[model samples]
Target chain A: MSEYTPLSEVGEFGLIRLINEKIELRNSSTIKGIGDDAAVLEPGEKQIVVSSDMLLEGVHFDLTFCPLKHLGYKAVAVNVSDIAAMNAKPTQITVNIALGARYTVEAVEELYEGIRLACENYKVDLVGGDTTSSHGGLVLSVTAIGEVAKGESVLRSGAKVNDLICVTGDLGAAYMGLQILEREKQAFMANPDMQPELEGKQYIVGRQLRPEARMDVVYDLKERGIKPTAMIDISDGLASELFHICKQSGVGATVYKDNLPADEQMLQTALDFNIDPLTCIMNGGEDYELLFTVPLSDHEKLKNHPDISIIGVITEESEGINLATKHGNSYPLKAQGWSHF
Target chain B: MSEYTPLSEVGEFGLIRLINEKIELRNSSTIKGIGDDAAVLEPGEKQIVVSSDMLLEGVHFDLTFCPLKHLGYKAVAVNVSDIAAMNAKPTQITVNIALGARYTVEAVEELYEGIRLACENYKVDLVGGDTTSSHGGLVLSVTAIGEVAKGESVLRSGAKVNDLICVTGDLGAAYMGLQILEREKQAFMANPDMQPELEGKQYIVGRQLRPEARMDVVYDLKERGIKPTAMIDISDGLASELFHICKQSGVGATVYKDNLPADEQMLQTALDFNIDPLTCIMNGGEDYELLFTVPLSDHEKLKNHPDISIIGVITEESEGINLATKHGNSYPLKAQGWSHF
Candidate 1:
């Protein structure tokens, strides 16, 4: 195989065909997919929801540890997570990628492999997008289209006083995973012969490298005939998302410190690094968990679910957003979500 | 004003609010805009058409010659042009932008100013997006959502033998404008006191810096009771787009070289640079014009339209795509569209 086939050799049309052949559309709403100026969808009676996110290299990830395939999967997963947060089922996604000339056909194929895998896993169609050259590094921007019954889609502003605050899966695992990866990268750079010290760190590392969107939770809740009054994906930490809900819903929340779910491996890694687990859970970003609220009457349906934890309850605006400690003390919660700049 | 206020000072939420406040939704279909995980739209009986495009600094635009305001407008206009290519009316757009730390709050506002202006001009709503910091340089990604009655949206594969090919507006002015801009930049760099030779060049320069999507032609066609058999936007070039239509429709085209439309200014500039005007009209990029085909029965309806030109006639696949010159010589057409990679 050639060490590197310059992208110019493939040309724009060749590269487009190369990527287009690999996509398999799974959504029935997709009337036409790719190979066109725009993707067409038949949404029918359902209202359509759309959201877009852009990720830049060096700002969002370090290439030293990030694999192109994993990066592609993460980009799609993160965007789908946003759709799930709206209590809407993602029907299609358009992924636009701009890459520097240093990449080869093989490199792009790897990235699309991950993207296609995620599309299949999420059961969403690969609809339309643009492939272009970048000045340098890789820039990925994804727009997800979803559908929900009119008035059924949830929003951050729907929470009210007495609403029960709940969260899906565990928090801070992805954050701890990043720290481990960073340390391993430094050691590997110092000694080219050293293998990564990743033993017993598989869970956390996987969380960081391939965090899954909580679509299962959305499905599970719908099956149980429950609707979250408010919902948001935990891309920017729990406390920060809580602030969004509180500020928008004109309410307050009190989450217990002990109730915050932390994986055993995540906690252990946090201790080893002398980083407080609570801080990681509160401030570290990219967990992709679901943070939502339900009315008090619906608590019985969710309390028994092992994947979910009832962490707190909503309160009047005067009560303020606070974190209640195991020691019975409450303090105002501050948001320190990822601020790349 | 504070000199170069670091973006870190305002945080992501603040930046979001700064841009969001300026956007006012004009589309009644937009049930919910920004501040939610996704924007909701009610398209009723119309089919949803979506398209996304990403623009990277240095690759898609040179900041030295392109102003931020025009760049933002161009980014959104280009994506809308894709939707128009499908014969759809764009309703909403989501814009995602990544900027380097060198960008000030003022710079971001200026970019959004252009975006808002384009949205207003196109009657599109600014529905949802993510704003984040980049590693360096500027990156803009826009997703345009449009709606058309079921079976009304045009496709590249609809053209049949004997269909009359039509093109809107003029071509190649944007490419010449870029050439003039590059020349002026080089001259200005070499001699600080030298003035730009851009007088009487507004038409070409406007085409390059702020090309508008041809939605006017779509409306006119609807009024004239004509539906294009096949349609595509002249983004890459007229020849490149015609190639797409031919490949998808399983037909060939015969375009008269003399019938291809070119602005007087564009023709003069091509002569000044010693560039073949025919090549410029056929292969130059960024025109953002619409190319479509109408049945012979509807040809008389469009023949009287001042802005529309009957450029060619479709032929059987066996004949091959060819161009006929004024002197009666014919040759196979080649699509040398922009291949930046």
Candidate 2:
């Protein structure tokens, strides 16, 4: 029989020691990782980029369907996605977690295992963090640090008129995956003996559970010597992010409805749910795809890229943001992003 | 009647705009504040020190007695105290907040008002952050950035045998204050009629509600040309932090029981609660005072200082950590730190 060890047995310092002993720092920029009041970093010529995000249990995730390991991975991935949206290379991260009394030492270890795996996959170092108790649910907040050459970073404000709009991969799969999960959860609640019908929806389910940040697109653009005029990750939805770029860059855009990329599985799932595929592609959130703009002169280099689609071109500020239908009709775009309040 | 605006009415981007409009970056190092994928900073010459802390609403604070403004101020101060423990000058901070749906825009502004006040007082910049909704309670995670010259930072591993152990200000006041608050809360719950019997407990109550980090001691030590060998903020009780220094530095310490700092109000409150004052000084937490060790040669510089008290001396590892009682008995000291888990 296993003996129970209350967290009070080891106290705060012992818990910190247990966790810190397993952390291995890989970045040279991280002069100090843990076991100190603060972590220290070496100065460099490149400009540093910092982004943070907080995920709450039951709000950002449901423990019933979201495993602790996947939650940890998603927390780090989302913060890293913010850094990647600036077209920079992530170097270090700090993760702060607050857990209720229900968590065990082994459970926290599993969460850290996922965090460590993400750090290894992204080549980012885990520098420092705080672990404390929560009143009720779990809270995970991650801060990502990255670097870009003095003027090489692509901000949301740099797009110019006639710039070609580009996006990586497809959209709406993650949103559809969430719909499937919620439906399955309701079915299980209604009938305890019912099995989850997740057989043919693996693609969408995986997309929702473990969305990957488009770091590959960032690297590809760098290798091709093409700097995006403006860039942002599709997190709150394609429509909202596009509006951010347009408002910040003081320009407007006209996107072709036919050019919007949507996976076949996502379209089928949207049809099954009685939702328009175009609406899903435009307003569904958490795609984690890279949406960027490149000058007209650099169009040829990206025209044949398999994973990228040139969907529109930047227009004058007065033109307003619009989506042109396949029927040759145009409608002004309105941002319908996710709200967590 | 108050109008209700569902967060969905404005969406995520609109909420971001609402918050960003109130932020004004004041530090020159804050090259970029918000609006981009990440905030950018330019720290010159000095080594950057990063410290983080998370405050959960029912764990770290009771909103019933703690004002939101004070909670915000306390969050920033706690993180700043960590930087001060490293003998660094705090320069900037990023605050991430997750609030429930019951919060209003005005309430958030009040919290920021307190944050801005603390930042202005400390000459620190509010650089960046993330704001989102929480499912249960409020959570605030702050990362403070500071700078110190190379080789000037004092880590817990730098303490040496025969060094003078020193503490700044009185301990146990915050803990005693907490006891008073808890008692009052119980009374309120039982009757819900009698007014809170708070009188002449202002000092301790304030200490618990809005404790200030001793950054002044850091500046004064530099001015006096006195560098501590090792240091840590007394946020986790004196005995517990001393254990950290001893374990990390591979040494032992002997503190005099009579030398423990205790405020008059704290002693009275402890007695009123039927608890020993010395025990409160030993194991009660959240004082935000400075506990440090200095070479014997430098003791004279601080000996005459009113706030600095030399409580003990470092010893060899074989001596173990001990406390010499006023009754002429020596006993091994055990850390009874706060355990959130």
Candidate 3:
């Protein structure tokens, strides 16, 4: 074991200088990045969208299994997912992080390295933020700002009756990944010498540890000239998000159980854990995939998209949100979102 | 004793709904507020500025003496201070808060009430945020967004030689307030039944609990046709901030000790604590007051202002930053900023 330099050796100002020295601004709208009271931006004619998220250790993630780099990446991706859900292009982000005294300068650099990588991958500039010390576990708060054309941004209340509902990518993988991690932790705790079995669980575990925002889908949609009528990211399960769109839009939805997309690995893992695959699809959280609605006329344009699933259709409010089975039976949809409280 | 409802009773979504119901959007630029994936804004033809801050309970404040409402207001005020330092009008803010399981619904409501009051006072719209549960102390993260006309924004790197350095309001008050609170806390800890004996320290205590951002001075300076060559908020003491301005602008500063402003209460309290009054003024933190520089030609326009003090003059970079005594003596200014780590 090697001795590492503690955070106190760098101090707050030194830490900020270290972080700032490596940051490169990627957006033209960013007038000032760091080393200022606030970051300045010139958005010109584009409307701005702002989203914030806070991740706390022991609540949002367990550092025992989650790497700091992946945690940092996931934190930025979650906020970017919100901006992408608004049908916007992310431009800048401010990260406010609190670290315990036990953390080292090298640890802080590793976390920021992941954040910097995410910023580069997403084409967003790292702007201003606050750095402070905490007595408890690590806490990270991120605020992402994005831009969209005047009339192109989508809202949760824009869905109309007869609209076609769509979901990007497969779901339930991330939640199952969390279950696998928890089980492996338990097994390791029971026997310290045990080699945890994780060979075939790479994909599901990756989904849980590092989820990517569907910004690519937002760009692809813009290039294809298809704007979503209503959009939201799947952070609190698909059923819960559907409820949000329906409630805000004063409409209802009918999603087919068979149409719900799931990764094959996630389905197999759910069965291995004696959990229903449909339950994982409907109520599992933190997918970071886009769930949206579009006009029925856009069906021909989106039907054959490789990664998109035509999951459902919007209906009148009186009809109620329902899930249709392959056996021609229907049941009112129920949502059990992950409630931190 | 009354029965307090647990935070778990409302859940995260219910808590969000409760908060959203009380919020009223105050800015026209806010196209959409709460109940969305991301808040939308239209800052047409204007440049935007963003600043973020995270305050941890044990690190930043002691909940035993500090009220929840004041904590929330101070959180907003500090972030807004960063925006003020950029010479911009605050338009919106997004708050991300993590509450411990011990916190009740009423406690959360009290916190947001303070945030709501600050938003109303600052004329900023409460746009969006994330609320989650924490295992440790309470955490409040605020991100303030403001706008300025193109080329009107001030940065810390603009000061040049011969520019007159100005600071708004008195300093050392907030730091002294913290001292008084700590003394009173210690007294209470020694004897549980003893009164606080805070009869004469109201002003200083208030300064610590609720420091206001000097947006009024920004408006006043603009009205009087004085644009600060450089600006920054005094969060980590005046001397430390002066170093930032000098380092960024490639200039030195010579501040007169006699010109350092301090409230009479703070001066008296410094003597009461057997501490040097000069130390309290130069090295005290959390003033949230603007320290700015203006050209020599603008002196006549700002010299008569009641709250503004002409503390120093920018000099050539080789001169070094110094403090001049009233007795014709000069000393190199040393700054011991608050280092949490």
Candidate 4:
């Protein structure tokens, strides 16, 4: 067995001192990072955007299959996704984690390593956070701070009729990935000696375990001088996010089934699980892709973008949100996103 | 029983709508609140301060005696206290909560009601949050955003030799309050039908359950033209926080035992519990009062303040941090704050 140091051996203050030694502040706006009652930031002329999200063990992830590092990265990524949806650049984040008695100092370091990696990848500073003990399982909450130029920020209530609806990258791979992992876990549980089969499922599994926020798409749109009329990250599935956009904007949308983007591995895994691919694409959560609307005039700028899919068009509220099938039949879309409750 | 609607019946979206309808944004800096992917704020010409804190059920509070509303209020107050310690005014807050299946819609409403009241009292906008179901008891995380003039913010690393050590209100009351509550709980467990006696302990008990952030002191200091040389909120006891300021500032402090502020009820409770009052005053946690240092020149401005107490003085690092007793005996201070590891 490897060395295991109980958290009690190094008290909270000692643990904080240990963590503080390794943190490096990356943002110029951060006047003071850790070691203060609160982090001080000078956002300068930019408007600040704040987003918060929480993930709980057993409900959000199973520690048996999910590594602490990936879980930490995913927690930050989900909060960053929210900031990305606002057409902003993430600058700083504060993470609050509660660990149970079973966790060791090494375990916390592993978790924080992932958090640090994500912070580096996203170019955001780990400014401040709180760490405490929990009685049940690990609980993590991340709050991301971002900045957007005046009048450049996007909102979910800006979509208008005749706007083109777009989505970044692909969806449903994460959902299919979750299915494969669950299946493997079930197989492993049934027979202790059997090795779980996960061949040819790396893409789907990775998507489920380590999703990335579409900051690239946000930057690309800015470089192309295109501002989204409305935007939301696909955390609660495509259909659910579209509902939020439509309801907030007082408009309806029509998405063509053929235009829905799906990764090859995701489609294969969905078929292997005998589930409808469209269901996985439209109702699967945690994709962290941006679902947005751009003016029809900007379609020419985005039409040839390989990573983007123009899936729908905004319509009057009376039209209702609908999905057009390959068979030419239109049906109202139902948002069945993951509901923990 | 009153109407009990399970969370599943309303779904996540429905619950969000219910919560959104009741939130009232109070800050002019809040450009957009709730509903969007993130909340937007325009902190014109001011530096922003961010603070985050998390509270876990069974760990931070005992549900057996702690009401849901008080817990909710305490969560916000604690985070706000962190911001106040930086000499900033809290402008906005984002809350993330995970509740178990046992929680009902009414229960959630009660929790939010307390949150809403805190928001009103602090004049902070409840801008954004994430709500999800957990497998265990409730988990709450709150991030507070505040603003201060670019050069007006205080840090724990600015104390200089000969600075006056000041504290707001009284200390040890909240810890003593907890002792009384625990005693009552044990008594109640021994005899379930016995009515709990809490008549004479109102002041101390209120201090424990509904501790307020010392934002009033921050404003008062500003109005009186006094900028603290160093400041920190006493969430982890006087001795521990003093250690932080001294270590960060590279100075030592001499606190007089006779000057340590104590509430009458707290002193009485300590006697009743057969605990040393000085231990409660110096090592007790979660008082939520401001412990700070100011230049010796500003002592005259603060000397007559009713709620402020001049407890000690900053000294050269070689002097060491010590507590001077009334008997002319001085002993090195020991920090024994709460360790939730």
- List all candidate RMSDs to the true structure: 1.1, 2.0, 1.0, 1.1
Candidate with the larger DockQ of 2 and 3: 3
Off by over 4 Å in 1: A1-4, B1-4
Q: For each candidate, what TM-score against the reference?
A: 0.99, 0.96, 0.99, 0.99
Angstrom error at residue A55, model 3: 0.4
In the range A204-261, model 4's lDDT, one tens digit per residue, is: 8999899999999999999999999999999889999999999999999999999999
Supply candidate 2's per-residue lDDT for A333: 96
Which regions in candidate 3 have their CA more than 4 angstroms from the true location?
Answer: B1-3
Q: Compute the lDDT of residue B172 as modeled in candidate 3.
A: 95
Report the C-alpha lDDT of model 3 over B1-341, residue by residue, as the tens digit.
65787888888888898989999987889999988999999999999999999999989999978999999999999988999999999999999999989999999888988999899999999999999988899999999999999999999999999999999999999999999999999999999898997899999999999999999998999999999999999999999999999999999999998998999999999999999988888888898999999999999998878999999999999999999989999898876898888
Query: Which pairs of residues collide in candidate 2?
Result: none
DockQ of 2: 0.69
Which stretch of 10 consecutive residues in model 3 chain B shows the poorest summed lDDT? B1-10
Q: Give me the overall lDDT of model 2.
A: 0.87
Candidate 1 predicts chain B with a TM-score of: 0.98
Q: State the lDDT at A104 in candidate 4.
A: 92
Residue A71 displacement in candidate 1 (angstroms): 1.2
User: Model 4, B273-341: lDDT tens per residue?
Assistant: 899999999999899999999999998898979999999999999999999989999999988888797
